[model samples]
Target: MDLTLGAVLRRGLLAGLAAGVAAALVALFVVEPVIRDALVVEEARAAAEPAGAHEEELVTRTTQVIGGMLAAVVVALCLAVVLAVVFAAVRHRLPGGTDFGRLGALAAYGFVTVALLPGVKYPANPPAVGDPDTVTTRTLQYFSLIAAAIAVTWLAFAVRNALRRRDWPAPRAVVVSTIAAVTGYVLLLVLWPANPDPIPADIASLLWRFRLASLAELAALWGTLGLTMGLLLTTRRTPATPATAAT
Candidate 1:
């Protein structure tokens, strides 16, 4: 398609930034309120205890809206940059290079590695959930899972490449690699510590809703970015007809 690296990065980053904005909108309008409600419930339960410094000045509705939106944009921008780099890195590894199929696969890979796998190990919790003291520990666990997921993906690629070199059938190599990645992921899920903070049954519904919202938000971001990149690439690859070229 004669696309340069700079063009790819520029387009990918723009798409990602746009996707992040869209995701933040969903979070601000849909997810944050539910989380806020959940926090209220928590606050009532802890009303009697002397408020710790961390607990003081709970995230107000206004701050939630403003902060959530800003955070979403910033996070999306950063995430998009990284995803763009990853897309470039894996472009050659993908069959047929940077086609729509490759774009879709990259998006799916990003979602799985960045969101699903890590979330499975440490799903997003409501604001009021978890021990404040363990914030550092929990953060490490979550990021560690992310790193592990990336490692597992890299390992799958390595396995596939090794098998391919050994004259294994393409289909067989893919299957074996898929199985290896899944097995590694499952093991990570089991070995990792999930959210252990007990939630009452009543708040379960809210928590469930919040988690779903969180997933939807991220899915939306990746979906937008993927679709945008696909469109951009397709447009770029389109041939100019005689009439169009003359014009």
Candidate 2:
């Protein structure tokens, strides 16, 4: 039950390792297949177009798309490492057998990371698409948002056990994680130029990109959370076997 700096560091490192492995596996098996299928469909559509459209143009577009996807993947991996460390460190400061509380804290942390930050940065609009014809873009945007929400949820549960036992002040981990995530997001947005031709003309387009970025961030946080929780839960003491009745 002793919460020390060394314990926190050890837990964070272990969590980050586990999260990185899990995120990599998921990217290879699940996310890759889906991305590949989308690319194939896009290729087919491009192929069916009239001749003299310049196949090289299509190739260039495809390359850009792939590059963006890969960049997103790398970002996700990094996020996982960071989140794992943060969650592990926070959990280490809390008391033992506090899984439920840990989860609650994580969920709060996620909300702060995803919803609160964006709400602060951008104005809210009616959650509706401006153009019905841009369904593909809208769908991708929503998909990214859902993925982000799921990742946050996963992180919340991972830390639930640890949070239950701690007397740490409310919103500490959540606030810190949110600030870190937002700061990182702003830096990336500023340092990296915007796409010359962004899809969708209005709020929907912005939301879509926001969703994608959130998904990456959430993945990183959850990956770390999973690793830390797994370690704590597995290494904790187990109850002794019951005494045998007289034969």
Candidate 3:
């Protein structure tokens, strides 16, 4: 079968849409709730009070936060799907050069998702130490692990794209992009600090403040990955002309 740019972009959009929806569903219904429950349990334990004392309050608050977050994620996913479909249609209609429209759609989706990260409530666990330094360290460590996982996932996609194209000449672009993304994330984590307060006590307030920073970091990673892949896939040598070939 002939491989057209339109077809390629359509596939990419479909893949992205599917993945985005899956992630949203899991994050909304499963992961967030589990984390919230764990956080509540931890909070209750740390308080050295009966869980029943604050069970109702905890449930109500967590439910409200999780509900709002789920709604936001659903909205974002819908927007992403709509944008992707539009991009695919446009690319199909205007078949000329490789479609960067799909890349733009992906970037937009990623941006929206990242933007919501600030609203994500980290479960409140008792601070291991009363000192702010320990809290800071723990926060950094957790965020670092999360950032690393995100970076690794992006790199995996890059590698998969390269493999699909059978253009393993040297993944310099991928390597460079990955390094830049990781660096940006690390810098953001260190320079832009969030409050050391764990969970419900600090979660809601910090969500808005730190959300943008996290989004920026995620945007850097997404931009790096998308741009690198776009560059590699779109830039290719032209076919030799008859005169040049004869020589």
Winning model by lDDT: 1
lDDT minimum window of 10 residues, candidate 3 = 121-130
Q: Compose the digit string of candidate 1's lDDT tens values, residues 107-204.
A: 77778888988766777778777787888888888899889889998898789888988999878988998899899899889988876556567778
Model 2 per-residue lDDT tens digits across residues 1-247: 4444455455545554555555555544445544554445456656788876534554564575455455645654454445445556666443233644553355345545554434333322222323446556645544455355445444543443334346434455445444554455455334432223334443454454445544544454464555455456446553475324411
RMSD of each: 4.2, 11.8, 12.4
lDDT of 1 at 139: 86
Candidate 3 versus truth, CA RMSD in Å, comes to 12.4
Which whole-number lDDT from 0 to 100 does residue 91 have in model 2?
Answer: 61
lDDT of 3 by residue, 1-247 (tens): 1235554455444444444444445455544544555565558566897555543454575676567455544554454455445444444332123545445534543443343232232323222213455766756645664565455435544553555357543355446544655554455445544646444553454333334433433344345434543443344333454223311
Q: On TM-score, who's better, 2 or 3?
A: 2
- In model 3, state the lDDT of residue 223: 50
Ranking by lDDT: 1, 2, 3
lDDT, candidate 1, equals 0.78
Query: What's model 3's TM-score?
Result: 0.34
Per-candidate Cα lDDT values, in order, are 0.78, 0.48, 0.46
